[model samples]
Target: MVHQIRPRNSASASMASRKISSMLPSLMRQVIVAFIVGVLAACASRAPAPAPGAPAAQEPAPVRLGPLGGPLAVPGTLSQYRSHWVPVAWEELPGWQDDALHEAWEAWLRNCERPAPAFAPLCPEARRLSIASEEEQRAWMQERLRPYRIESADGNANGLLTSYFEPELQAARVRGDGYEVPLYAPPPGLPARQPWYTREQIETRPEVQAQLAARVIAWVRDPIEALVLHIQGTGRLRVQEADGSTRLVRVAFAGTNNQPYQSVGKWLLERGLVRDATWPGISAWAQANPDRVQEMLWANPRYVFFREEPLDALAADAGPRGAQGVPLTPGRSIAVDRSSIPYGTPVWLASDGPSAHLARLVMAQDTGSAIVGAVRADYFAGSGEAAGELAGRLKQNLRLWALWPRQ
Candidate 1:
């Protein structure tokens, strides 16, 4: 669907003009002030007079979609599935709930500090049990399972922690040992597991230990005010090339704090300018006002302030690899639970001012930090500053369809 252009309110227009003015510095900051003046003078001098009989350009073609897929069954739907949500219960630790821990965790995640080496001792046991030679690990796992007499109807550990715990243990080992974490393909038919690492291993790894120590210190220092929150959102945009080619792009935005912009779709719905809150509806509106696109986004505080890099950077980061380091190519992306959304399903994302009806066939290869709940996804929109901007302004509902499932 396409949106028709309408005159904007004077207030909105004024806000747009102010926003454009403010953006000039950031957008053109690299250029010298004198250069900018000269460029503006040249533009003024070269401004062309409009021809009386000129005709408006034709609108571009609308995005299209293929077949829609059916809904995916939620993971762990089977009786055999076993999963647990382990909350960080550090609050229970006396003097450990202070703000130090929160700060440490953040520093560690940013790779600014290393975890301690105390976690090394636990690595051997973890490796022996889970990541030893394939034969040894398998034998150990079999022996452990023999005691529980736990058997799956499929004879597969479809929902068992044993399937993934070992790998996690190994990962912890590598990280704690100060070795580069090796990315590996999971064995076929195994359920995901939270890789286990010993506390000592966690404390010993420079990065991990730094985080642990920081968190502990923070809690010890300021328990009451140390809480932390994460926020995230995803949206699409219509990008116009200087040569006139147009493309629809999807972006993801993540940040700290409980900001309202974290809910991209909600922010758009509240705007009330678009008739429909869905992706197509908003894309239609954005396309009509190409010149004021950035203004509309900046007007909403929730839609701005992307953590990490900018929009362009983020898109570049989503190279052919999934977040989990899984390889992806055109027509092949990752998907998580179909209940969330099936893997390998094609979706039409409308964003910016153009519609990407068949923009990209995204696979649900990996999960996202905030990608919980049904109908949630983090489209890998590449990486860097451009990607960040695109990600930040992504506030729109989408018409999601599973092209793989005959819907």
Candidate 2:
């Protein structure tokens, strides 16, 4: 949702300024332990095994003893999971200063403040954000911020800002939490473009101007929390259609070699798909192909790989042999942020698939080009002849959490 459309004359300078502004919060120190635990829980629950020629869905298999019990013992402590933090501008804080926006944010924060809550335990560290000295705050900001700059296809620059969030913050309000916070509906008669300023009306829109001012104030005064980052990857999926059709859909950046058959950009260019190509194309293609989707996945090399067992028993069985002749198992693998969650941490992932209830400790052995940012992960199904049939057919939303050292 980038709103700044104007181009900047200098790109590097904009990035440098943005980098300095997006600082990590001191509160991050308090949540490290909990954040690490969350990552491990997610890795422990990998995707369940797929039934022969079945469409992938979210389900866990009955727990079974594998040769390797859980995530392999590693040298580093969870403390090592701490890495650089980045600052993010609060450009789109939803209901900025509007009564609705204020209520939503405050309610969310209050729920976070509760003790032993379902969400990450809120600490005084976050509450104490206002006391820092300017120098201290600037120093902290410099240490953790990563500049997010926009560069157009023509190499022209766009507006820049210091915006980023800590990688570990997780906050959400769910049903039955018992707090009974009502949802905020949009204000009556709100314009279609409540905040976005058109070139012609930028000078005349008093509400828009006030909204922007309020956003800046919130950015300056609010205590920092987790950051949201984007992850991009290239892969192929085998989509199955209800009509018993199947298709191999390539997914990647538009110019990449493995672009999905119905990629959004391509579809837009071909006028077969609308503006948001990748997601829409994949969805549309799946609707068109159903029965042979699994088979099509088995045929593609881009979507299959091995998920390392949390503790590589075969590797450990080799007893210091170090990745030698370890028997690899055929299973799905996912890439996760090593910083928020360590690599090789065991996770429990629940998906809608045949592999439901299948439990296995996972090794964070690999990363994909698109698998970056906190709370982000990538899953890999096995490879070679054994995996050929079950690879790309996986298309399911997953709920992930980790299992690790008791807090």
Error in Å for residue 175 of model 1: 22
Root-mean-square deviation per candidate: 25.2, 27.4
Candidate 1, residue 390: Cα displacement in angstroms equals 0.8
Show model 2 residue runs off by greater than 4 Å: 1-76, 80-329, 353-358, 384-389, 405-407
Residue-by-residue lDDT tens digits, candidate 2, 1-407: 00000000000000001221232333332231111111111122232243478665333322222122211232234333422212123121111112212212222233233322212332243234335554443343223322211112232221111101112112122222221111111223334423322211322357744543322100111111101111111112232323546443322211111211121123233644333333334334434553422322222111111111222333221111001111212232344545544443333334434322322323333343334444343443332222222221332334344433222
Q: lDDT (CA) for every model shown?
A: 0.26, 0.26
Query: Scored by Cα lDDT, where does model 1 land?
Result: 0.26
- RMSD of model 2, in Å? 27.4
Off by over 4 Å in 1: 1-320, 323-325, 328-338, 348-360, 405-407
* Candidate 1: tens digits of C-alpha lDDT, residues 8-40: 000010111222222222322221111111111
Model 1, residue 127: C-alpha shift (Å):
37
Q: What's the true lDDT of residue 219 in model 1?
A: 10
